[model samples]
Target: MAAAIERLLSEISESEDPLEELRSLRTAVSETPLSGLRESFSAPQLRVIFSLLNTNDKEQVEVCVDVLERVLQVLDPTHLVQNCKSELQSGLNHPDDSVKVLALSQIGRVVSHAEGTIEVLNNPEILQDVIQSIGAERISVSKEAIATLLKLSNTKAGLDGLFHSDLLKDLKDVMAISDVIRYRVYELVVELSLVSPVCLEYCANSRFISQLLEELTGDDVLIRATAIEMVTNLAQSQHGRQYLAQQGIMDKISNMIIAADSDSFSSFYLPGLVKFFGNLAIMDSPQQVCESYPAFLNTVFNMALNPDPSLTPVALDTLGLLGGTVEGKQVLHKTGDQFKSVLKRMSQLARDGATDLRVRSLEAITQLLVLPVEQQTDDLLLLTESWFASLSSQPMEMIKHISTQPFPELHCCALRIYTAIACQEWAQRLMMSTPGFTEWVVDRSVGKGKEAKDCKFELVGALLSSPSTREIFGAQNYLKLKTYLQEGPYYVSAVSSVTTEGAD
Candidate 1:
């Protein structure tokens, strides 16, 4: 193909009938497989091809243009951009208006992909041509040019060139032009702002943020959703947050959440809304977080307290995600007796016949109990004692049902909570009642086995912490665990004798 095209170019450059030779070459180039053709053509071949493409023969020029685009990946990849620019400028001057527009759009793509392309794009002459192409009355040409500009704006250097080349204000013009290009422009704003925070800082005081925020209330769901997402990113930055908060966006979003309307849950706004509030919790100070806690907690608590069980789990999980903080814990404390009421309610739900509700109820109870002792009172001890006594008499079948359920998170929570309570006496009572329970715990704790290990590690931890339980663990019933502790992992034996002799 390269030899054939070279022969044809030579023939066309010298023939008495150049047009005929150009026509024949156009046909051959059109028939050539684009992939194989690019591999064959050198940079010189492309320059000669571009030279012939600018000829008066429109069909020859058009075919060359089509083939040129398909072969772009195989081109110099960066150099010889000036040749394409000159040819495009010549094509733009053609008598045929469609030919002119095609030339302009093609020029944009070439420049967009060109290495060292920024120099050409930033030139006042080329910048004017790009803007003129975008504003052309021919909708197809104008749309193509605008789309190309938006894509070009995605690159850091390209965006920087635009900012320096009067392209920024020109982008605002394209953004104001409606239709599909509007979304493209909106996305460009987001990309542009995200890529360069310095650009965003500069644009922060501009009308762009206001324009985008106003779109949040637009009737179009996509626009609202995009606006929410944009606000989310913008608000995450300290500058963005300061800007939105000054605009009263914080109050507006809170009210929107409270309203709980259809628009808030629409495809575009829902994730944005959740992210917005979630980010708010992250952004606020502990004091500020505490101040807003009651409103958030009451809203979630009422939803959890509702008669329909379906919303309870979703609301519980959402609330957990939202209030996962010390300040949130403070909110729970401030709710006073209401907090106690919710705990009792969870206990009731845990006792309910529905397994799913019981699981969620158990989780909520675990969350409340996992807090520090300073955060709770002895009232919870009575509650646990009641549940423990009930479990002690329950059938083995019932115990299996509780233990076999595959909630590892719940199991870990149970381990931590139960360990917190398992003083030596309580542990002895547990072992006596369950028989081989310490062995079960040890097997699970230490082995590849599903059960726990029986070691003095558990008993020692329990005994040292609870004075009464220590006295009970000193007796014969716990002798095996006591022996294991003397022989095992903690080297409790290595320290125990010296400590015991001192005490003696």
Candidate 2:
């Protein structure tokens, strides 16, 4: 094994195809036991592998990094920091972004240990190198550098090293590079803030959150769009939400939505703004958000009617998210005629719009209509039933026709819609009243693919699980439906004994 390692190293230095040599070394190092690797691999030999990162070939650099990660796993962490530290630091300072990424990755691996974290954090030059790499021209290098910094932040010593020193100042300098890089740093800040309230406090103190919030109302619509997304991410946590609310960021966003109606370039940032409020609604109380910001619901309904392809889907998705909760459903239901118009539009889009629009519209309808057994109140049920009725004169037949389409995604989505409503008494009555609908439910071959089959099984399970099934379908049909559920989604009879099959 030692001789083989020597031969591969020699080939890597001499061979015209060093990538092949690197690949061979990667496989060798991965398969060999740690003991065998330690006996054969020396520190100088690993440095030689590290030198491969200087190469122009991206694939070769990747293979070299891969081999080093495996070999480094077996080596003592102290030895790596003591011996290989300079080599990795050079890689980080290397002019080539690929080399920098390779180095950042190795440092990331090292910093996963307590001692390695302390060592890297103590070295100002190496630490600065990693932070500056966040602004690298190549996104891959920037991403790796950000990942390394995130790993460092995971450890107490490393976290203090970052937040206690000129870390924020360095990050602020990096943000001056470009809007693209700025958002990358913002992403890191948002991620770190989510770690704990203490980490969030560090982020807030750094003024990074303030800078991010300012970007929302900034002149650049694209930046405003980008900024809102990060702000939305920060709002995901309880403390973060409290912080943003304290700043009146929600109300400010509400004002932006109202102002968007007159802005010609609103399309650029409008979707993100709607999504922020949508997520905010779902995260907090839907009733509270909608009641607090009537413009949010109003804009969503308007965007749904808008012909701009980009805006409509966002609006549909936001609607779906808002309707996922009981409060959200009630909020929409209370919109009355305004909500009815939106439902009418959604029904049309579900049948005749683009594939994505159709799917999203169906999903929104399902979220609005489906009620969990626990949350099923008389008022909510009536609201869902009314929404379903308002969808079309024959909502069931339209969805059934959609299920017949060849696309498996549409088929599965349609089945999910049925499953969502299968337990409702009004839905059950409609199924019984509709021609061949009950037979369609029990038909094993009605849908194709594993997902569609699973969805069909769920629908049957929902029906059988419902209290009204025995009374609604009668004992005979109820037994047949129950047997279908028991047989499972993928069940098939060995003998083909179909009395009749429904039309595709």
Candidate 3:
């Protein structure tokens, strides 16, 4: 393999065309790890290959950058970067935008661990070069440049260094040039915000905030959504939210979305608009939240009925949160037609043939029950009939199926709902009539600990925890069931306790 790699390196060095040489090297590296190939090349030969990154021919430079990216795999990236700094600087200065982006791309890879990489950490200009690339004329160049900056910002040195530079102005310069670059840069800004309080403060620049607010109502759908999301990320911090509210962004959005004329602006983007305010309302004072979202619930309700599967889940989540608030509950009660329709929609979704969607719909219904009246009223019959009525008029078979669900949360949640209904007098008779309910509780509850896949202990625990349902199980085997429950985790909680991170 050493001799074969040496032969390939010799062929690469002698090739008349650098692109052709890179092509041969790419194939060799793919078949043999670059580690294996690096040992065969003498130091001088490696420099010759690395020097191709400085080639003024843009296409060959791209190919060569691709080669350097692979070489860094087996070679010491920090060492190679320092050794080839002059060439990389030349690549950065190349007039062709592609070479500049590719150079920044490589720099991004090299400075990835800024704590240890003296070439970038010790040098301020290397970080400046990355920031300057953000203002490149071409979008691709700036996009890669932003990605480069994102990688740098993740490092401790990068964090300490980026917050100190005139990064805000350079990022604003990119945002001013193109909406495409604007959002991409904002994503990097959000990352930088996570690292430092000063960076988050810079992101609150008045001019930048004004532009983001203006873009919130822009003619373009993509631009509007981008603006909303940037605001969302910033809202993650309390100071960030205070800055946003000081700008009156929350009120501006509330007025704009509530305006009858704003439908054209928001119809396609209702999900984003709903989410923007939903997030805002959650973060603000309860009195302010109560006064702010009176008109938006109908739009969210409509989203529940919209056939777009992806939108439906987020919309349902928003609705569930809305229903939890004091004002949102009143809104649901005031608009019973809309409220029941949503319940009916959730019920239908719970019964859908798709298991995953069924799980989501069931969970959403559980969130709705946070509003006590909704649960005590129509939602009660609707959910029970949707999840349980299919197997029997009761929950015995329904609870059994739930206990065996692949996801433990589903078992925990569905049974919690089933438990609510089971405490009712009629539900007791339903449990008494079902044979599978007894078998699952007694066999799994008191039987040996647990098995490979199936678990029903959470369900068993739920049943025994309740006085009404416990009576239905009869008192003869009470002590045995009690002893089994006392043992470590029942199957359901036991399975839930297992963390699968890094498992085979």
Candidate 4:
């Protein structure tokens, strides 16, 4: 295949009108395996092919780019772009809009290959050409220009050029004037945000957030939801939220959540809206946010208890998001009985062939069971036991599936519940008789589990919290349990003395 492609390239190079030969080459190249293409073309030969893209014929330009796009799978970008720059710049100015747009898209691919190359984006002439094309009357030129600018934004040199030039302001103007351009602009902003959080600060300070937030209030739910995501990213910094709050944007987001909630919230944007406010609620502070804790808690609970299993996961996630705060923790504790009921019902659903529900059941259990001791009680333990019973009744293969899932938090919850039950001597003895009970207890105590490690403090606290656990473990398992509970200054000194020669 390499021989054939090479022979065809030689034939095409010798032809008076290589366009016809190049057209044939495309078919042959496509059929020829990619490895063959790479093997057939040396760097010099590939450079020659890229150089042909400068032709006046649009067909020749397209075929050249198409072939390079394929060859790029193996060709190095430094060599590819060095030879193709003039050709691409010429193609970008082609009379045919399709040719121009395709050239721009291909440029993105090429620049992506040479990702860290500053020289590609640093060329003053190329930057000016792209900026001029951005203001072109033709939509294709405009789109290509936006794409190229986005690609340019990939390099620091490109970003430096954009900062020095009027590109940012121009892109903003185009975004304001054209709906087609606005989506691309917002998307570019989001993409840039990953590389630089400061990029979001620019978006927030610019009219972009205001424009996006205005769309959130619009009738189009899709736009509203997208705007919500855009705002959410921007709100990641405290300054971003303060900017929103100053502009009364938080009130708008809160209102949108309430308004969106009045209906089913089954739209694509609903999740983003829910997440945005959920983030805002936690980030801004619980007591200060105009919304009351009970109202927010009830709303989340309703969503958790919804018939749709999908809502349960996000609701559980929201609870986890809020779970980090003191107020949120206190609220979950205050509503312990309600959470227990939900857990009981979810466990029943887990038994009734709703595998997805069971997955989310573990998630909710992770959040609830990891709550403070004021949140834990005998009722919660009963709910946990019922879920375990359901899980244990499953076939061995199904049990393996449950074991593989990533739920370190769920494991911690299990340990804490184990500690709770272990505090009761009768229950501890009963659990000891259960299948694989000893291994499970040891695993929870000092095993290779995240929650296992986290439960260390809780283990000591639980043992010391209950007179029975202290007396029982103190009598029989004191040394072992003390070894497990060895943390903090006192334990550090004790362990250090044991290790020191002649110190004891």
State which candidate has the highest lDDT. 2
**Compared to the true structure, candidate 3 yields what TM-score?**
0.61
Cα-based lDDT for every prediction:
0.55, 0.86, 0.62, 0.59
Top candidate on TM-score is: 2
Candidate 1's displacement at residue 148, Å, is 12
| TM value for model 1 | 0.48
Quote each prediction's TM-score. Answer: 0.48, 0.91, 0.61, 0.56
> Where in model 3 is the C-alpha error above 4 Å?
1-45, 51-78, 86-106, 109-144, 154-173, 219-222, 260-262, 280-292, 296-314, 321-341, 348-360, 369-471, 474-504
Better of 1 and 3 by lDDT: 3
**TM-score computed on alpha carbons, candidate 2:** 0.91
Greater-TM-score candidate between 2 and 4: 2
- lDDT of each residue in 1-504, candidate 1, tens digit only: 667777887876566546666666666677777766666666665666566655676776666666555555455534545545665566555555565566666656655674635656645565555655554556666666656565566566765676655766776776666645555555545544654566565455445667777876777776776677777777666766776788888777666556554443443454455556656665765346436633445545665666666446654554444334445545555666665555555555655536677666555443433333343335444443443444334422233344444654334333433454455233346544665555554342332223223322553454444545445544553565455555654332233444555574
Lowest-lDDT window of 10 residues in candidate 3? Answer: 446-455
Of 3 and 4, which scores higher on TM-score? 3
- The number of clashing residue pairs in each candidate reads 13, 0, 0, 0
lDDT per residue (tens digit) for residues 1-504 in model 2: 667777898888777668887888888777778878876777887888887777678788778778876787777766787788889888888776666876788788778888888888778678888999988888899899889988888877887888788875787888898888899999999998988888888888888889899989999888888998999899899888898989999889999999998999999998888888888888889999899999999999998988888899998998888888888888888888998998899999999999989999999888888887778888888988998888889889988999999988889888888888888888889999999999998998888889889888888888887898899998989989989988888998897655656745
Give per-residue lDDT, candidate 3, residue 56. 61
lDDT for each residue of candidate 3 in 1-504, tens digit (9 for 90 to 100): 566657767877787675776776666666776567667555566677766665567777666666656665565567657676766666677777766875787787787765334567677666666766776777787778778777776655565556545654555665676666677666776655655566566545425555666787787876777787787777777777776778887777667656633455455566676787677666664335645555566566777787767568767777667655655555555665666777667666655525666667666655544323334445444543343344334435544565456655556556555544443434556666766555555564433324411234454454566565556657764555566567635434445557698987
Question: Lowest summed-lDDT stretch of 10 residues in model 1?
Answer: 447-456
Model 3 lDDT vs. the true structure? Answer: 0.62
Show where candidate 1 strays beyond 4 Å.
1-117, 123-160, 163-197, 219-226, 258-275, 290-294, 306-314, 339-403, 406-504
